[model samples]
Target chain A: MSNTLTPVLSGRADSPRLAWVLKRPELGVGGLAVVAMVVIGSINPAFWDAANLFSLLRANVITGILALGVMIVMLSGGIDVSFPAFAIAAMYLTIKGMIALGYDGVVLPFAVATMIGLLLGLINGLFVYGLRMIPLIVTLGTGTAVRGLLLGAVGSSQINIDRMPPALIGFGRLEFLRSVGGGNGLSTMVVLYAALAVMVHLMLRHTLIGRSIFALGGSEEAARRAGFNVRTTIFFIYGMAGALAGCTGLLHGSMIWVANPRDMVGIELDVIAAVVLGGTSIFGGRGSVMGTMLGVFTLVLLTNSLIIMHIDTTWQRIVTGSIVILAAAATSWRDRRIAA
Target chain B: MTATPARRMLALRPRRVDPALVQMAALAVVVFILMASLNPQRFLRPYVFDSITYMAPELGLLSIAMMLTMLSGGIDLSVIGLANLAGILAGLFFHATAGASGPDLRHAGAAVLCGGIGIAVTAGIVGGAINGLLITRARVTPILATIGSGQIFTGIALVLTGGPAIVGFPGAWSAIGNGRVLGVAAPLVIFIVIAGTIGGLLTRTPFGLSLKLIGTNTRAATFSGLRTGRTVLLSYILSGTLAATAGILLSARTNAAKSDYGISYLLQAVLIAVLGGTNPAGGRGSVWGVTLALFALMLLSSGLQLMRFSNFLVDFIWGAFLLLSIALNALRQRRR
Candidate 1:
């Protein structure tokens, strides 16, 4: 785990296979995903259909982006349940603002949503740092307040497709590699998620701020002693999370063509599970963008395949929860063995 | 000059009175006064009091359950889900024995009531044990573990109900929810007994002492030869039992059970637990503090309802209250 946290300039000069397997824990999740995909595809011919594949990829868009954000926060040893609230608030509010301003441009709406999210995330950073309270409690407080305020004071009504901005909806509907009759094509969201994943990966691996976040997660005291501005870094991490959530929320609403105040309820646990499943340590200071994305992919595949296999959709929650418990237990058992 | 007065007050401060409980007591009084003044006729009526007592027990039990977990340096986010699952299972029990059809409760005997309630209690025990095993034996983080189990519990409930409220409990069964014991709500009486028993368990037992020690410092407790794992596991089981009792009460009150009933109670329970001075980081809380906080919030919300405030506004206030209390606790600790 410690080796994974630090940058590895050179590979271990031991028997390459075992060393490589041990070094990249995320490969396990990827392998599991592949196996599950193959088993499901074999069981159900529809699983390999382009339409099914595109829809599954589409389903992963918002959640995958959220998982990437959460991966960053978890790397800093904080758990945030408030991102979903902030995401919906940003999305609903942004759409409402666009409607009021009679503005329909895609880029501006996204920028405004991102800014709103950044502001909300900064507030979380402030509370967590200023109050010196647990992240879970603080975020719970803010999340509830924001959700309450959004639904109560702002407006609880759904902004349906009838009222949505035309350009924004158009952007959401954009796709590449379309069939002649437009029966199957990849959603623009897939591209958006991929691009964001790459950007996050580069930022986390190649930037000083990203290193500081890892250091902070490893040990706040150590990071402080090592000349890191822990406060700014904390603020940056939360701000980034919020910004991503905000951006993703608007994208989600645009893709669905509806901005419901109650959208994205109960997504916190799922996103957290995905990030954890991806080989990110729940304790923080050990995660990667690729791992988090793979985690999301695996989770999306597992749940989506349940439907393809003619299983009850309600079983999805039970399956996801079981996976979370099993994964966490496995991680703990492995860590204990190492300690011994 | 201000520092001198503050220092003098601190010197005179007695170690016996808990400031958090006292604060809650004062807040309760203030809220009572404000509500009374705002609508003397409506707020001071027996009907309002009866309704408050009626509604407070389930949430009150939940807060107590949450407080117990917090006292041991952990939390159980699954209580609400566990409660719903318990209720659904018990509801299924009534459907099985008494029959689910309308006005056909001929088999609604004392035996049936007991059986239904027993089933709910058993569900709680099993659910709590799973959570306990996960946190203790499997070494999963309490929050993550509970979150996962909560989903599983809710999912099971959903599968059983298939997306609709299960109605038709025996008249006697629902009487527990709506019936009065000597002019007091039955649920209120049940709440008092359970809260009192749990309070006594926490204050006057070796188990309580062990819990406090563990929460304050688990390593020290472990070194001192305390059974930390066993104690935590027991606490979770107890928490689950309490939540299940609340579930039965809820089902009885509504005369129906559903997978997603009382969804908002989860956060409200957390709010009440924290407001009651249960430290989220673990250790240092009380059943009495929780009861007082519950009364205060109930009074505040009831009053606000009289003033035509929406439920969402009440939620916002609850969240604000949680944050404010956390900040106050931080300030108090810093001062010490």
Candidate 2:
């Protein structure tokens, strides 16, 4: 709207009252999520069951990780729809490599796949920073390229897994929250998600680099004048996103126990919806990892409840889409009102 | 003496250049040459022309819709979804009135077909109005608003038929989609007429001029007393209607309507529009440029299929090409 190629991701941090409200958007959204849960649980007692929560957490694993990655990108005043492609490509290549190379080892395969993902993200960073292109277009192009590569080359042979790397299977089955869910416990993947969330939360709150990211999102010129290396910060943001995507891909493949090529193709929308709905401003500098965490849970819970209610799955998209728009509109409107 | 004569000849000649036109012409040449070399047999045939003509209209129309929206500094992500919903609605009408699995649907007559077409177009227009309302009235960003509406439309479509294809149109409906007028597919003819009319609207009409002004600077336009909101709303309505028409054509030709019809078209439409040189930031584009882009892509894709290349391969090329061209476009802007 302002003639800036990147439509502002976050709101300005200068407004005292507005910034306070913006920074604390999660409280409102989180409350709504709780309300929805209570209402839905009353409607269907099964919705409150531990099994449902366990499965919901499992489903949230991929989206939760993706939200963390997207939060970083969005905070930096950019968007990355390319991460699903990154994850898919990374996982596909890893799966293919395992079969073709017969690598029984855990660390090597994942390391190679993640490096590839990082490389892909670096490409996005270069296009956005060096070429000075819009982040959406840069990532869109790269994302499509990665998807094309996956479909063109390794996509034809979807390998069914008879055996997984010892590490993956071990990671998948390990139970956390042993006291909950009727002995099924919380999944290892969900546990991993919590750990990652804490790590990201700390990074965003305490670290100088994290603070600079917010500054950059608020305004690049100001960030530059404040002595932040804008390009390096952006590059790192995209790279970090890519690395996270790769990790998620491995987890996905492990959970399914099959290297299905078509997996995670259109899931970017869900991830984005979750993050944005969680109260992350599309125009950056106002959001939190914890908020994103709540957003992911909100989405998962909504979808789960709909299924339990026997509502057509098609309605999920409608709801998700509406939530995204309403969240964004409310934020934008509030920001405008505050600015005025 | 020879050098003097050569220098004189070079200096005497006048130079003329139109960069946009030159770029478009060059793209056409490149696509033609690639196609001709790769699958000379089929591409060299007259039938291939018909095939290209047949496929071009639906895609071409969607691109025009996107281009128009982008020209106004907005986007309509809901077009494909809207189109499908419109088609599905039409299908429901025909199915209820005439019955499914009917014999020789062509004999269902022009009146019935006209009604079906009208419903689709009207639904499209209505959908567009909603999108416009959301943006202008609600203050939602174009992208997010359209996306939300798109989801709603898709949900409705699925609910209408429960995620199944709606079949059973009269045989005559296919004639409109597949038949020829002066050896040209009717859809192609419709496309040309639509393109010509819209082209005129953008360049010749006051509405078009005002829309452009609005896109270039909304605040300034508003200050000048232009009804910026109304203009945006009309642009979206036009887009929605066009997408609906495309949907009608698609369903008529395929003889079915489904929620997933042209599912891949959303991104492809945007790609083609951008490739046509519609400025994503808005306030710059040309109908001829978009038309040429449509032609080039049609050729490249059709040719690749003729050569037995996988669908994924073409997608790859398109993505890279869009990226490359955008990069080049930016570089050129920098140079200027």
Candidate 3:
């Protein structure tokens, strides 16, 4: 009865083409995203317009970057909820530092922000490795503490668009594929996202450290036995994640031309949902860059195009939550099949 | 080496002290002293105690709910979302039934009050069932499932309320939040009764034993023929129910229901539950421990507030306290 009820779970790939598609790993999410785009586009022709497509891409760029960082951590069998806080702190402090020094250069500011993020990530890595507590709890505590301290002892005020560094704003304005009819061209952020995604994909596929991350996530003790220096890998993943988050935060602020301390609140769930939807296992030791990028695209389209499709904006959360559940269920079913 | 003073002292004491009790007592004394030294007149007043009694119950209930799931090797991140949704639904019930003047349940009669409670509790049960099914049947990871469910709950609340708070609960309902029983605050009384009842259930019931066994070792529990799935489901249902109770208290106290009410309470609940000695990895926790931890945090927060500390600083302290307590617990486990 249950087998009949769950056809997707019970059915095996009957054809060579179907089996090949399934084995590629990335095709599943990529195909789902294409289908979603077509459906949404058909429902609302406006969704296919260059402006709307650009807006969708804009919304995804920051979250996509953050999700990449989270994907790396998840790949290493750890959960991090602290990146948002670190990102904001790094962005805000970098701006404040620039203002205080009366300096307005893009390169130095981004470098400083990345360094700050790396430092915060190292702290999380320290606690997770040293205290040997669960990553979720450790990150939760650190995230809260970092946010609170930033608001309390540091500054709670927002850096408005006018007060933003001109150089950084100019950097954000650099774009390509300038559309006709006065439409805003795609920002340089898309290029950055693509480059970063490709870089992460290559690193994960080619590097020894990347393999160590997978091994650590698969089984910590086993990784240790294999002489992978599990501690270094743990530190490396978190630090890398933090650095990316920090850079993305500043990128977000520059694009929007403001740094609000409260921005990025409650984004952990959305990014995590997207990553897992992309086929990254919450239990770790599985996932891919292509899958995660496609997953983010699907999520961004669904959320951004709700208005165009005549759905209530509030329904976005419901749909996203359902996606998370369905994705996790699919992952669980697949894991069981492999085990069997 | 055998005749050392420390060894002799250890030999002299047959029973070890409960760390939860010690932590609770030490926290109380420290907070009391600190507050007294800072502002003796203001801190020692009945008004301050009254305020703390009123504020702690909702958070206290949520912490207990969090503890229950943790004890079963799971967690309920949906507590806050479930809580707000429950409150909003109950408020909507009263809003729809009450004549154009708005719901003033004080004179609306006993049946109306019962209806509100019933609505909230049923929502809790339904929400908990969803979480349970996702975890046990769908086999989604507990955290991921709860996170998703929490989002759904909050979204529903947002859709229902249209981003604004639902006001006008029955006056009688507010009385439950604000009224006193023999000079004690009503919320405190309710908290005590529920806490005591849960404490009894955990110690005296088969379900409780099975939950702990499952947490401690799932394979062993299955070998022993324990109903692991049912126990996990009950844990979530009970967690949801407790969260609903907190929701009722929140609406009654504030006289309104919103989608984002008590959002910060989620973190605090997790922190308090863990500080109360509920292991994050599961298999061990006590109602008494959680109760003590609740009081300790309440007093500590109250003391900090009395000192005119900013809310941000308070949040920082709570996070620090959680980290410190976890570190201490880890060290203690290492020693064992």
Candidate 4:
């Protein structure tokens, strides 16, 4: 058995054909997601229903946005463990500021919220890139500070969006394909998610900044030697992530009708899980927006199915966590095989 | 008086006492001054020592676990989860055997002693094993793996209790958690013992040396045939065990267990570890430094509570301190 395996292993190592088959790791995750969907749908009839499917996509948007930010940071060879807290903080401050300023109108709130998010992200980037500190520790600190700021800003009362302007409420309530016979099939938020995904895909694959991010992730020193403004790029990446997280927070506020400091506490776990499950390497330098989208979808679908099945929320968390571990393990196995 | 080659080598080796320790000491001084200014009478009260002694044990255990993992160049974010789980498990074990209504005086003493130490140690070791398996054999990054496992562990705890607090443990168990020995809390004593033992292991044993080498340079460790994978695995296991033990102590003290029991400890553990001068990038840290950091943090927190500061203010201050520490560490490393 050893002799036979040795010949096969050596032959494969020498062959480009075998290498091509071995190199792609994301395919395994994609395949597992498909299998999981089929098996789950088969076991639970409601899993394939349109209403459940739409909610899965809708629920996934927030995670999708956060994961997108995480992907960029990871692509730049950094990790942001503070996004959940930052997202909640950004959301709280944006809504509070708007309310205090009496800019209850739609355009102003959106603009201000985005700007606030951008500013917050810039701080993260500055501390991480400019100060040359570890991204994890810096963001963790900033994340706590931001959460505290939100608590102080909002006090004990949660800002209820129900009293907001009708137009803002409509934006929150906006759904796509509702008039068509699909039973409120899609949402504007879902459309935004898709658009963002497309834009990110292009930026990562086509643009010079995207290439630079990939180069940085691949090797920071090499990229620096290659004339890439590594610090500037890092700042941009982290800032972009923060801005996106802020936008997601706004979306969350609109969707949930409240911006509480405690809401979404420790949610970075979910975002990171989605990124990892989508087959992105934690070591950074390689990822796909499409894969992340799928990852988000898988988690959302799983959660929805558990709810539909009336499984307890606690069990749901366990299942979701197990899935993340399984996904990570699968990715690692694939990487090892490729390396071997 | 020419410097010998040995002396030069010793000088070149990373300082036995990290410069971060100096910053921490400075931070401690600043904190003391701030506390004094805020409320001199309360700050000087002997009762504050009691508070520190009470909080030290669990914090110490948590800091040691965190320090061990950080030294091996990984972070275990799942300690809180593991601790919560262990606490719940201990509660259930006590409740089942001793009755859930009140203190089972007949069995309470043994249960408290055996259950507290036994369940804690087992949970700690097992949790560490899982982390080790995932990180080593499965080749998952420590942060992601631990975070995922943490969720799973917390979920299990939640499931066990149906998302409610598990209470009605024997009084004797509580006594051990709340009891003092030699003018200090038992928990503080436990912390000292564990920290001292682990510290000795980390600094004295071949295993400890290997861990430091692995954390500093994995490829170099591997090339030296140090079994880098096993070393990482062991560190993670040790971390898991320590976290679990902390959880048990927490449950015993509170006389109840909840899924959220260890949640608040997560950030605190990391903060204490780093504040104690453990490099975030892994390798080069000490139990002694972390122990001092634990006391400093406990003092600061207790001081804030006495001052009627809002939880938000406390959080903000802590976050500021964490950021400042990291920034200072970065600067010092750059200078080196």
Candidate 5:
């Protein structure tokens, strides 16, 4: 029996492919999210209502965008705790700068906001790569600094958009897909999120840089030995995260029509949780854009259901926290079981 | 010639003392300079001491709890949630037993002693056990597992109280939290004793050494026959207990227990642990370093408050300090 097991374990090609898919691991979380959505929708008719569905997707857009950036960082075997602060900072600065300069036109402000985001990302990248500092520490520091900058810039006042240039507000309200009944539709942001998700999926799965990311995450030393520039990979990953965060900031500004320094406070935890729940390993080296999308959806649905049920916001936080923990636990247990 | 060679060798050898202690010393010097420069006259006053003393108890206890888990190479993100829940539970128990009509001395005493200490400790241990079982046995990571448990516990607290605060505890309980005992607040006394006990245990006891071994090198520790799982589990239990104790103290001090009581302490506790030189990756740290770090943090916050900074500013400062300390520590390690 021992001899037979050894042969199978070391078998040349046939069995290894099966083992690879089993170990990819995120498939389980993705499956679970689908099951949860189906079960919940079956139980509550309102869950399937087109208006509610669109609204749910809309609510998750900001988190989804944030999670996309986080997924990139996580895949690079690093964590970024500063994305939320960066987002808030980007939003405040972009709004205030646009207002201060009287560039009320939509396109110019958008580009400037994105450029600010890219610069912020570049700073984070430099700190993590050039300085050889830990991502967690570097990002945490930047997160704080960014938040402080926002507070100092905006003071204590919330900057409201009174008559935003049609194009900017249009991004949030523009419907891309109208339902057959004509009572509900998908907004431009949701389409953007889906397209971005697809793009990230392709980048992670198909591109050479994407493979290098996986390699770096799997083992930095090995990746370096394989002729990959580990520092460059890390820098780009963090930059991608920052850029996505910037996009989310713009989305947030458009949706709320206000930029408050304190808005989306403590949202990093949610982003991390969503990424983890989506089946990305906290230690990195593994992730999936699709799984993360499902995770965002699951969380948004959970929060919406809680609201519909009239649960307090505090309890909702507790529940969301618990679900995140349980999801990570379940994934871990499954991984161990497969290993055995 | 032999003596001179030996002296050279001694001078070349690297220091083996705890980095955390050294960091704490550096932080203290920085604080001292700041205090002297900012407001020398008021800084030395008893009122400042009073403020520092008042802030120490719960935060100190929280830092110690965070230190234990971190030393074991794990994190307890749920400490804040547990503390909040425990505080709320203690408040509810105190109010129920003591009656809302007025301060019932006997009932209040029972609540503080039994309700606060007994129930809180038990709950904390159970919470820790749950986290341990999930992480060690079920293979869940520390952050996710504890976070999940934290959520459940917080939810339970909210459900128990219907999301409102539990207030109107007997004045005696508040007195115990607020009163001076031997020239220090009672919570401060408790904090000192607990810190001393924890410090002694980590340095002097076999269990402590086992924790260090596990934290430093899990595989090696396991190979050496240390019960790694059990040791990790015990650390979580200790963390949970301390968090719960902090919760009870907070409830006693405020004469109310709200769900938000411990929410703010999460970042602060982790910051104290890291700033005091506790490695985020785990293994090397000191109890004294954590205690001193707590004091430094408290002083910083108090000073910032006095300067009329917003809560957001204080939060940003804490986040910055945490990041800076860890990054500096990493740089130091790389040089070594």
Candidate 6:
């Protein structure tokens, strides 16, 4: 039974004094992450090497950013399988538009991309709020449509940015504490990931809108009865997700230095998986930003360690798929166990 | 409006004329007229119709498979994955036994056909069974379970085929893909027969009744003494098997099997099933509706191609149509 969604560590609170641990949703994931690092680090000290770790972080940070967005949507009881497509479209447009305008700057391209993403997310919000349609189907359709339209706009011809504004790539490349971890401390992308995580965490933990999101996810009818403006919250949540995705697309593109319209079409699954693996319930009402980050690291570490050992990336999907199943199974087991 | 005996009898008849079907049917007719007027030269040709007949069935089969799952109140996102995996297995079996350059190819042709089918069908049933067990025993929601299994199946397919499409089937393999039966494509014949059998199973069997009841309300069905778990299990397995049928036809038609073939169909098949009027919440659908929806979509798709619109535009239109239909349906339901 795949519904074993709540963290086993948190569930242990029923036995006593472990309630403190339950309050820290990210603890178990973080501990497991440390164990994973030590194991992988011992297996191959190269994994602890700065370059490999940085590369792993770089490989994961896209999903890391997107997972924060996914966590928001999931926490609100709606799903957006279309965010990758949405992000990809916004990224493609921004890159192409910037290249055409010969514009190159960190803020300008990112702002433009984020605004585009916001608009698209607003459309998703409108469908959920106005039409009263199922969020999953609505987003799936719109997401597909966006990708198709983007593909139509950009053919097989790959858009290369030879004159990429140094400021844009520099933002992604900027590293802090370069002397640490054998001269690989951290990149600006990691900084951005942390910044976003902190911002979202504060908003979720302290803000009224954040409380409403949790309430809405817990039960729409109950939220409505509690005087939460469910429609407005849904709009804001999906819109925020969209804007984040847009930023993700640009961040990913600039990091890679190419605007391949076809890439990341189905990458939302990875984002969703990472968030869920972090102990987020797929049916909503519970998840955390920090846990999601840990989840992202855990997945990336597994993948990076395997690739370090010369195992093919194809097996990564197998493990991820199995983890999703196991997580879901755990949730189901928990539900039944609690019921009993 | 006074009801006589005859009028009362008519009112009691099943299927009180659904407006959504009527609306869709009208849209189909209008689109046909528009296509004919814009591209009469190509649209009017028999060969154009032949191509539609050929291409529509594979997509149709996948849609119907989704429709079956939807009928039971769950969806099989893994259907396409299962279908492709089945095809890949059949392909691997054929490749191993009667490859083009094999010395025993002369005697192994029949083996290729038989073995190809035997392996493919078994793969479908097994995949479907796994889906069933995951949903019923594992207690995973259908979407998450299928998504996970879909990934696994796709990974296995990729690992087995090593990314490249496996080709080089026996010469007779062409008959199922390219050969004509009477006036229809062999693929069409296969599609129709399978659709009809599945349709009959859904309509004529007690299993169908139980599934519908289960979908409408699982607790109610259980209280009323139906094996809800078994019903869920059977429906998913059938959906998987149907996906396999599509996979086999795909291999036969393309003369190849790859991990990613018809990957796009995952979205489109869902589109078709929903467009065919299967309730997303489950319990109410008809194969006839799916068949009709298949015609509408295929017509739109073929028309767009006939006009030389890029394939991406076709994708756009399908997505737009799905959104529009759902919106309209919601509005209509609210009005009622």
| Top candidate when judged by lDDT against the true structure | 1
C-alpha RMSD for every candidate: 5.0, 7.0, 4.7, 3.9, 5.4, 4.1
Model 3 CA lDDT for position A168: 86
Query: Considering TM-score, which of the candidate structures 1 and 3 is the better prediction for this target?
Result: 3
Stretches of candidate 2 exceeding 4 Å from the true structure: A1-22, B1-18, B104-106
Candidate 3 lDDT, B1-336, residue by residue in tens: 334333433343326666766876677678778877888877888888899899999999999999999987888999999999999999988877774244344467788889989999999999999999899999998888999999999999999988999877788889988989999999999999999998888877887767776777677667667888999999999999999999999999999999999878988999989988887777777888898888878888887888899999898898888888878888887888
Clashing pairs for model 5 are none
Q: Estimate each model's TM-score.
A: 0.94, 0.92, 0.95, 0.93, 0.90, 0.93
Query: Tens digits of per-residue lDDT for model 4 on A1-340?
Result: 1211233355555477545633443454566567768878888877777776777778888889889999899878788977777777766776767667666656667666677777888888888876777787788888887787667645757766665444566677788766552677676888888998899999999998898998998888999999988878987898889888878887888877777668888778778877877877777777789778878777777776775666777787787788778877866664566667
Candidate 6 global TM-score:
0.93
Most accurate candidate by TM-score: 3
- lDDT by residue for model 6 (B12-108), tens: 3346766656766887788889899999998988887888777888889889988888877888989888888998998777667766445554345
Q: State the DockQ of every prediction.
A: 0.66, 0.50, 0.69, 0.69, 0.47, 0.64
lDDT (Cα, 0-100) at B1 in candidate 2: 25
Instruction: List, residue by residue over A1-340, the lDDT tens digit for candidate 5.
Output: 1211233345433366545654554555556556667877777767777778778888888899899989888888787878888887777787777667666666666666667777788788887777666576577667776787567546757876673444566666777568642666777788788898899899889998898888987888899999998877877788788888887887788877777767887677777778877778766677788878878777777767775665566577676777677667655654554456
Q: Where in model 1 is the C-alpha error above 4 Å?
A: A1-23, A180-182, A338-340, B1-14, B102-107
**DockQ, structure candidate 6:** 0.64
Docking class of 5: acceptable
Q: What TM-score does the predicted chain A of each candidate obtain versus native chain A?
A: 0.93, 0.90, 0.94, 0.89, 0.87, 0.90
Question: Comparing 5 and 6 by DockQ, which wins?
Answer: 6
Clashes of 2: 11
Evaluate fnat for each of the predicted models and list the values in order: 0.70, 0.54, 0.65, 0.68, 0.55, 0.63
Give the per-residue lDDT of model 4 (tens digit) for B166-285.
876666677668887887788878877888889888877878878877777676667667888888888988888888878867877887888987565777788899889887677678
Clashes of each: 0, 11, 2, 2, 0, 14
Pick the winner on TM-score between candidates 1 and 2.
Answer: 1
